[model samples]
Target: MTLTHFTFCSAFILGLMGLTFHRTHLLSALLCLEGTMLSLYLASSLWSSSFVLSTTSITPMLILTFSACEAGTGLSLMVATARTYGNDKLHNLNLLQC
Candidate 1:
């Protein structure tokens, strides 16, 4: 109901829409995936902050770390696709052909 929550939800939805509409470009999909992950991270952090518990949680850090790894992997895939196919179009990519 809060502004931050609304913003986070909007960002997440926009990222999903980007992924859906930009399915042709690998780079765009990667960027959208990162955006989705970032929004999830922000929302999780906000939710965690609402709990005034005795112990601290590292959920946000873990989410960030995994997102970074996912981004690196996606970038590597994009580079490989570009080098092999001359473009980053997902339609031209055929992993099963190899």
Candidate 2:
């Protein structure tokens, strides 16, 4: 297809791979989320170029805002987890068990 389609597809594939293979890495999850966001952004930008008052505009903006908020929260959680366990590994978050 077009470059836009290729970008979206690549981003989607990367996100899926990161999610599947790096479940224990918060950084990987963040990267996957970013990839998903980028794909959505690219799709929206492309769609908006062809239609009037496209829903894609608002959708991408909302997604970006949510992604920013999610990143902040995820970073905070990672920091807290790291401090408590001296590492950022997902398996190290066993403090809840105690």
lDDT by residue for model 1 over 1-98, one digit each (tens)? 88988999999999999999989899999999999999999888887788776343577888999999999999999998889889999987765764
Candidate 2 Cα misplacement greater than 4 A, ranges = 94-98
Determine which window of 10 residues in candidate 1 has minimal summed lDDT.
50-59
Output the lDDT of residue 46, model 2.
69
lDDT of 2 by residue, 1-98 (tens): 98868878888888888877898867777778788877777687667767777555677677778878888998999898878778777776565775
Q: Give the Å error, residue 78, model 1.
A: 0.7
TM-score of every prediction relative to native: 0.88, 0.80
Candidate 2 matches the true fold with a TM-score of 0.80
Candidate 1 wrong stretches, greater than 4 Å: 54-56, 96-98
- Say which candidate scores most in TM-score: 1
Each model's lDDT: 0.90, 0.78
